[model samples]
Target: MTLFKVLSYGKGFKGQAIWASVCSIVNKLFDIAPEILIGIAIDVVINQEDSFVANLGVVDPKEQLYLLGFLTFLIWAGESIFQYLYMKNWRELAQKIQHRFRVDCYGHIQQMDMRFFEDQSTGRLTSILNDDVNQLERFLNIGANDILQVVTSVVAVGAVFFLISTKLALLAFSPIPVIILGAFYFQRKAEPRYAEVREKAGQIASAINTNIAGVATIKSFTKERHEKKRISAISDEYVMANESAIKISSAFTPVIRMAILTGFLATFIVGGLDTLNGDLAVGAYGVLVFLTQRLLWPFRDLANTMDLYERGMASARRILGLLDEPIHIKDHAQAENIDLSGNIEMEDVTFKYESQTSAALKQINLTIKAGETHAFVGQTGSGKSTVIKLLMRYYHAQQGQVKMDGVLIENINIVSLRSQIGLVSQATFLFNASIFDNIQYGNEQATEAEVLKAAKLAEAHEFIVKLDQGYQTTVGESGVKLSGGQIQRIALARALLKNPPILILDEATSAVDNETEAAIQRSLKKIADGRTIILIAHRLSTVVHADQIHVLENGEFIESGSHETLLKNQGRYHQLWSIQTGGV
Candidate 1:
C-alpha cells in the first residue's frame, strides 16, 4: 500500500484532527505572548498610566492592570484547553491506526497461500503482527504529533521575532544549522542500529517459541543447559543491538543543548547592549530574551523526536515488507463454485512437494466412481498420502489434473471443494477445549444431538459417557489427556459429524489396538455405503472387502484387483495381506 493509503486511516476523524491542530496552534500562540506579557508588565510599572494598553485607549491605570490580568488568564487558559484537545486527538488517532493496521495485516496473511506459511516461521509472523505493529502505534500516538507541534512553534516564534527585531532574530537562530546537521548525522547512524535491534528481537522471540514448543524434547534429551545457553545468546544479541542505537542516540541531547546555549547567550548579550545604547526598547529587549529560550529549548528535544521517528520508520519498513509478500496461488477470476457429489478422478497426474527435487507421482491416472469404497495400499513414501493430498488440493499437481464431479479441482472454490470432504489422520489433533467442541469443530454449527450421534457411530460414546464430565471434559492440548485410541476415535467422530460426501481415512486405525481397529472398521463398513470412501491403512485386512484396491511401490501402482483376484495372482497386495494377517 502507498503512504497516502496508510495515512488515510485518519480520514474519518477530520473534525478531531482539525480541532486538535487548532488547539495546538492557539496554545503555542498564547505561549509565545507570555514573554511579551512579562515585558508589558514591566512597562506598566515603569510607564504608569502611559503604559502601552493605557496609552492606546484607557486612562485609568487600575483598569489597565485589570486588562493585563485578563490577558494573562486568557493566555494560560487557551494553552490549557489546546493541550487537552491535542492530547485527545493524538491518542484517539493512535488507537484507530493501531486497530486498522492490525486488522489489515491479519486479513492479508489469511489471503496468502499455504505454501507461504510453510516457508515462514510462526514466531516471525507473531512478532510482526504484535510487537512490530505496537512499535509503530507508539510512534504515531506521540511522535508524529510532537513533530507537527514543534514545527508550528518554530514558525510562529520565528515570525514574531523577525517582526519585532530582524537583527536579534538572526542572532537567535544562529544555532539552528548546527542542530540540524547534528540531527541528520545521528539519524543516518541510528537507522541501521535500530533495524538490527528489531531483527535480533525477532530472533529472540523465535528461539523462545521453539524452546517452549519443544520443551518435551529438551527434557527427553536432558538438554536444559544447552537450551538456556542458546536463549542467552539470542538475548545478548538483542541487548547489544539496542545498546548500539542507545550509544548514538544518547549524544543527541547534549550536542543540541550546547548549540542552544550559544543562541541564548548571543540573544541576551547583543539585544541587551542594544537596549543599553537606546537603539532598542527595554520591552523589546525583554521579549527577545524570553522568546530566544522558548524557540531554542525545544530543539534540545530534537534528539528524542528523531529517535522516535527513526524507530517508527524502521518498524514501518518491516511491516510493509510482510504485507508486500507476493501471492503466487490465488483463486482464479473465473473459478466457479464446486457442485460436489463425491465423484473423483486423477487424470494423467504428476505431483511433487514444493521442496522436493523429484515428482512423487508421475503420469498416474485413476478413477473412483460415485459412491464406492476404494483403497490405496502402499509402502512408506510410496505416494499413498500424495494421492490424498492431491485429492484434497493441498498442493497443486505439476501436470494433468485431479477432478471432482468431472470438473478440474483448480476451477473449484477451495472452501466449497474442501467442504465436501472429511478426513481422519493417524495422529489425531484436538484443541484444548471441551470434547463436544472438538467433535463439533468438524461442523461448528452442528447440534448437540448430531454430535452425539456421530460419536455413537464412531464407537466413542462409551468412553465419552464414562468420562467425569462426559462431552464437556476438556481434552487438553492435542488431546494429551486422552489415550491414543481415544484420540483416534474422537477424530473419527469429528469426521463423521461433518457428513461430507467423500471421506478419507489415512491410517485412522493404525494407532489403535486390534479391538478398537475392529470397532472402527465396523463403523466404517456402515458409513461407507452410498458415499465415495478412500481408506489408507497398513492393515490390509481392512481393505479385503473393498470394491477395488491399488497396491503401490516406488511411486508406481504395481497391482490393482479384488481380494480374490489379487490372492490368485499372489502379487504385492496378496503379499501385504499375508504379512498383515500373519499368513492366516
Candidate 2:
C-alpha cells in the first residue's frame, strides 16, 4: 500500500505530464548533442579532409570547427528553454494539486461524525493536513522531474553506446541489473522505516500541541519540568525513527556508485582496447566515454529521489486513508428539511458509543412540548451530554426513534436538523476575534445591532461595554482574555443570536460564581419563553423553576416530576437537592 502508484493521481494530469515528459526527454537529447559535437570536432581536427563533417560538405577544418560552435549554441539554447518549461509545468502542477487536495480533504473531514474526532488527535490531524501534504508537495516539485530526466538519459545514451561499440555497450550495461536489484532491496527495507518515522512525527506533534494548550495548567501544577521530559521522550522517538530510515536510505548511493564504477571502468577499458586495435573509431570512442559518465553520474541523484518518493508515499497512505474514512452521521438519501415546531420526543431510544461495551442510553422515552422547559439531573457520567448529542444528530441511536415535532430526526436533512437547535455547553469555545464577532458567530449575517441585542439578553453586554473597546474588543485564543462568566455569557449570546426553536444548555452555568449564575438565570428565564429549553445541570438550584425535572441513573430515567413533587417524593432528586440546599 505504501508503494507510490503514480497512475492513481497522474491520470487526471495526463496532458501536463505528457508535455513535461516530452520536454524532459527532448531537452536531454539536446543536452547530449554537445558531447557528440565534441567527438566530431576531434574527428575534424585529426582528419580534416576525411572527417565525418566532410561528408556533410564542410571539408575545411576551420569551417567544420565553426559549424560545431554554432550548433553548440543552438543546442544549449534549446536545452535551457525546455528545462524551463518542464520545471515550470511540474512545479505548477504540484502547487495546484496541493491547494485543491487540501480544501477537498478538509471538506470531507467536516462531514465525519463526532466519534471520528474523539478517536483522532488535533496534533495528528494538523500534521496530516499541513505536514504530510507539504511532504508530497516537496516530492512533486523536483523529485518527479529528476526521475523523468534520469530515465530519458538512460534510454538515449544506451542507444548511442550500442551504435558505437556493441561489445563495449554490453560491458557498460552489465552492472545495471545489480543496480536495479539493489534499488529494489533499498526500497523494500526503507518503506517500513519511513512509515514509522511518519507515525512518530504525528506523536511528537500531538505531544507539542497538548503541551502548548495546557501550558497554563502545567504552570498551575508546577509540572513544567515533567512536561519537558515527556515532550523530549516523544521527540526522541521521532529522532530514532528518522535515524532508522536514514541509515537504510543513505547506503543506497554508495552501493549504486560502486556498481556504477564497475560498469564505468569496464566500458573505459573495453572501449580503449577497441580504439587501439582500430576496431572502433577514436572519435566514436570519445562519444561512448562521455555518454557513460552522463548515464551513471545521475544514478547518484536517484538515491535522493527515491528517498523523497518513499517518504511522500508513506504520508500519502495516511492522507488517502483519512479521505476514504466512512462518514457515519451523514443525512439519509430520503432525508428532507423539516419545519421544526420545537416539540421533541425520544421513543424507546437506546444508544452506545462505538468504543464502549455498554449502552450509554437505555430504552428511555421522553418528550418536551413546544415552549416547555425540561431538566435532566444526574451525577457525572450519567449520559446527560450524550442525550444532547443524539438530539443534534452528532450521533445516531442504536434503537427506536428521536423525533423533532412529528418527523423522525434521521429522516430530516442534517443541516436543517442542526439549524433548528441552539446549544450552549459547559465548556464554551470562542474564536479569537472581537467580542461582536464572537457573539455573531452563529449568525454571520446578523447585523451589529442584533449582536448587541443578543449580548444584552445573555447579560454579557454590561461587561463588554465596560471594556475599553466595548463590542470590538478582541478575545484572545479560545477567549482566554475573558473570564469564565464572560466566556459563558458570550457563548449564550451566540446561541441566542441563532434564535433556533430548540435550545439545550448543558451545565451552562456550573463554572460561574453565584452572582454570575444568578445573572445568567435571569437571562435564561427571559429567553426560555416561547422556546423549548432542555437543561442538563449539575447545579440543583438552576433547575428549581424548570417545568419538569427527571432524575437519571445509569442509563435510565429513575424519577420524573415537577421540582416540588420531586422534593416531596424524597427520592434521588430529593437527596441531591437536600445536599445542595442543606434542607434550606
Candidate 3:
C-alpha cells in the first residue's frame, strides 16, 4: 500500500515509468530467447533434413545450422541493446524523481511554522532528506526493474513450457505457488523490522549530529568518553535493529531455493523420461530443462528485491509524511503585499507558547509611532523579546490584533511584512561567507558603496579593513572566526544595509565593549531620526534618551514614560538603573 502511495505521488513521472517498464519487459523477453534457439539448434542436428527448420523449407542441415548462427547473433545483439536502453531509462527516471522529491521536500520545510522546527531535530530531518531519499533512489534504479523482469521471465517462459507439453509444464510450475506464498510471508514479516531499522538509523544520525555541534561543550567539560559512549549506545541499537530485519530476509533465500530446486528436478526427471519413451521430442525436452532453470533461478533474487522494496517503502513513508505536514502559518487566501509606513500597534495582545502553561505576554497594549524611538526594559524572560517576535509575525498573538499602519498584520503578505523591518537580535547568526556577502544579504541588490556606508555607520568598517582580506574574508560557520563583538557589529551592519522603515535592536549591543557600545549608540542616534526604532535591552543606560521607556514585569508593562519620569517615580526602572550605575 505504501508502494502504491509512492507511485501515485510520482505520477508526474508516469510516462517515464511506463517507458522504463516496457523496456525492462522487452529486455527480459530477448534475454531468454537464446535458450529457445539452442533447443532448435539441437533439433536441426538430430532430425537433419527432417528437422523443424527443414519443414520450413530449409532442407539442407548445414544451411539450418548457418541460419541458427545468424539468428543467435541477432538475438544477442538485441538483448544487449535492450539492456542498455532499459538501464538508461531506469537510471534517468530515478535521478529525476530523487531530485524533485528532495527539492520539493526542502521547499515545504522552508514554509513551515517556527513551532514545527521546535518539535523536530536537525539530524532527523537531514537523514530523511539524504539517507531516506537515497534509499528510494536505490530501489528505483535496480529493484523496480528486477521485479518487472522477473515477472516477464515467468510469463514468457511459462507460455513456452505449456506449448511444448502441458503435463510437463504443469509439473514444472507446481512449486511456483509455494514460492509466491513464501514471498508474501517475507514481506509481511520484514515490513515492521525494516521500519525499525530506518527509525534506529535516524536516531544514530541525530546523536552524531548533536555531538558534533556540541563538541566544544563536550571538550570543555572533558566529557569525551561520555559522549563516545552515548554515540556507541545509539550505534549498537542501530545494529540490533538491522540484525532483526536481516534475520527474516536471510531466511527467505534458502526457503525459496528449495522450492526452485523442486521445479528444476521435476522438469529434468519427468521431461527426460518422456523423451526416452518417445512421447516427447529430445529438442523439446532440452528446451524444458534449460527454461526451467532460467525461470526458477531468478526467484533466488526475490528475497533481496523484496528487502529493497520494504526498505524503500519505509523511507517513502517518512518522506511523504513530512510532505503531508500542514503549513500552519501560510498566508491567507486574500493576503497581498502592501506598502507599510512603520506605525505599529498591539491592542489587548496575549500569547502563550504551546510548551508553556503560562502566558508569555498578557493584556499588552502598545503604540509605536512612525519615526520615533521607544525602548522596553525588563528582566530575562519578562516578555521583552516576545513583543518583537509578535511584531515580526514570527508567532501570532492568540487573543489580539497586531496592526501595522492600520492594517491587521495577518492580512499582509508575510514576506512583505518582514521585509520592511530590520531585526538585529542578541543571538546573531552569520552564514559562512565573505564579510561583504554577509552584510549584503540583507539587501541582495545593494551596491558595494552602500554596503560600505552601512558598515561604517555600524562602526564595523574600521575593524574589517584591518583584517587580512577585509570584506573578502571568509567567516567560518556561524561566524566562528570573529569575536562576539565583531559578529554583532556585522549583524548590525547587515540590518542597517536594509534601511528598513522599522529597525529593532534586541540587545544588539550586549556583547560589545563599552567604547564599541558608545560608538554604536552614536551611530544609532544618527540613523534613528526618521525611522521607527524599537529597543529591547537590560542596560538601562541605553534607554535613558529614548522618547518613551516602558518597564515590563511578569509580561505586564509596570511603568511607562520618559526615562527621566520613570527614574523620578523610583519604580522598577529606577531600581534597575541604580544597580547598573552604582547609585542608591
Candidate 4:
C-alpha cells in the first residue's frame, strides 16, 4: 500500500486524473510561450530587414510588434483557461479519492473480528481515517499537478535548447542530473522521518482522547497537573518528530538552488560567447537564458512537492495496511437464516484468550432449556462472562460446539442468530443522542408506542418522564448525563424492545445502589418468564432466586441445581451465599 497503490485504487477517476494532468502540462507550455515571444521582439528590434516575424508577411517592424501583442493576448488566454481547468479537476479528484478512502476503510474496519480492535487503539485508528485521508487529499489536490507540470516544463524547454544549439544546450542541461539525484536523496531520507512524525501525531491524538473520556476519573483522583505533564510530554515528542522532517525538507531547496545556479552560469558564459562570435543569433541567445531560469526555478518547488508526497505516502500505507488485513469471521456460503428456539447448549467447550497462557473456560458443558432462568456466579477471572462471548460467537470456541435449538451456531447466519439474542452488559454504552433514539436502536423499526411499552416494562418510564426533556433528553457521550442505575435501566429497556427469544444479562445490576438493585430485580421478575435467561453475576445475592444456579470455579462448573437445593448441599455456592448473608 504505497503511494502508487493509493493512486491505483482511484482508477475509477483515471480518465479525469489524466485530463487534469494534461491541462497542467498544456498550461505550462503556453505560460512558457511569453519568454519565446520576448526573444522574437528582440529579433524584430535588432534584425529589422529580415527578422523571423518579417518572413511571415508582416514586413513593417511596427506592425510586427502589434501582431506579437495580439498573439500574446491569445496565448495568455489559453494559459488562463487550462489553469482553471487543472485546478478544478485536481481539487475535485482529491475530494473523490478522500471520500473513497474513508468509506472503504471504515466499512472494512467494522467487519473485522472483535480481536482486531482489542489490539488497536481508538486514537491510532482515528488518525488513519481522518489525518491520513486528508494527507492524500492535499497531495492529489495540488502536489500531483505541480509535479507533472514541472517535469513537462523541463522536457519541453530542454528540447527547445537542443534545437537551437546542441553545444549550448549541453551547458544548460549539465546540472539537471545532479538536481534530480539530490531530490531522490532527499526523498529517501525524508520518507522515514515523516513516517515517524505521523506516528507521534497518532500518539498525541490518543492521549488527548483518552484524557477527555476519563475526565471524571482524573478529577476524582485530583491529577489534572499530572495529566497535563503527560500530555505535554507527548506534544513535545510530536514537535521533535516534525523538527526532524523539517531539517531534511528545508535542505532540499537550497541544495537544488546551487544546482540551478550551476546550470544558469554555464549557459550564461557559453551562450554569451556564441552570440558575440557571430556563431549564434543574439535573439536565440536571449531565449536560452530566460528558458534556463524557467526550467530550473520550478525545481525549487520540487522540494515542497516531494514533502507533500512523502507525508501522503506514509499515511496511505497505514490506511491501506488496515484495509489489507483479512477478516476472520464470515458467514458460510450457504448458512441458513432460520428461527431459533430459546434452548441453548454448550458441549465440552474450551476457550482461551489470545493473551492468556491458560484456557479461560476449560471443558465447560451446560444447557438451558426453553423458558428457563439460569444463573452463573463465580469470582472475577473465573470465566463467568466468557460464556456470553461464546454464545454470541464474538470469539470462536477453541474446542467443542455451541448450539441453539439443536443446530450448530457456526452453520447459522450471523445476522439471524444475533437478532434473536438480546444482551445488556455491566458497562452500558449509549450513543450521543436522545433517550428515545438509544432505545429505538435495538429495533429501529419499532413504533413510538412500542418504545414506550418497552420502557414501561423495564420500569424506566417513571423516571424518564421527570427529566427536563423527558424522552427527548440527549445522553452525553456514552450516556454520561445519566446515573449508573438510569443507564442500566435504559439499556434494559433497549434489550426488552428487541424482544429476542434469548436474553443474557451479564452483571446488569452489579453497579447500582440497594434501592436501584431492588427496582431492577422487580423488573427482572416481571420479564424473566417468557424467554431463556442467562444471568452472569459476581454478587451471590442477585442469583439466589434463579430457577437453576451454577457455581463456576476456575473455568469449570463445580455445582449446579435449584437455588435451595445447592444451599442445602453446602457447596461452593452455599459458601458464597453464606458470606453475602453474613453466615446466616
Report the C-alpha lDDT of model 1 over 480-509, residue by residue, as the tens digit. 799888998899899989898899999887
What 10-residue stretch in candidate 4 is worst by lDDT? 1-10
- What are the runs in model 3 whose C-alpha is more than 4 Å off? none
lDDT of 4 by residue, 53-101 (tens): 9999999999999999999999999999999999999999999999999
Q: Clashing pairs in model 3?
A: none
Compose the digit string of candidate 2's lDDT tens values, residues 2-59.
4344335656787987898888788888988888988888888888989999999988
Instruction: Evaluate all candidate structures by whole-model CA lDDT and list the values in order.
Output: 0.84, 0.88, 0.90, 0.90
- Each candidate's number of clashing pairs is 0, 0, 0, 0
lDDT, model 4, position 289: 92
Residues 1-584 of candidate 3 have per-residue lDDT tens digits of: 77887677568888988988998998898889889888999998999998899999999999999999999899889888889989999999988888888998999999998889999988899999999999999998999999999899999999999899999889888888999999899889999998888888888888888888788899999999999998898899899989989999999999999999999999999999999999999888988898998899999999999999989988998999999999877799899898777899999999999999999999999998999899999899899999998988889999989999989999999999989899999899999999999999999999999999999999999999999999999999889899888898899899999899999999987776787678778888889988999999988777788899998888999999998899899899989999999986
TM-score of 3: 0.96
Cα misplacement distance, residue 360 of candidate 4 (Å): 0.3
Candidate 2, residue 82: how far the Cα is off, in Å: 2.3
Name the candidate, 1 or 4, with the larger lDDT value: 4
Question: Candidate 1, 209: how far from true, in Å?
Answer: 1.8
TM-score of every candidate relative to the true structure: 0.91, 0.97, 0.96, 0.96
Q: For model 4, what is the alpha-carbon lDDT of residue 437?
A: 100
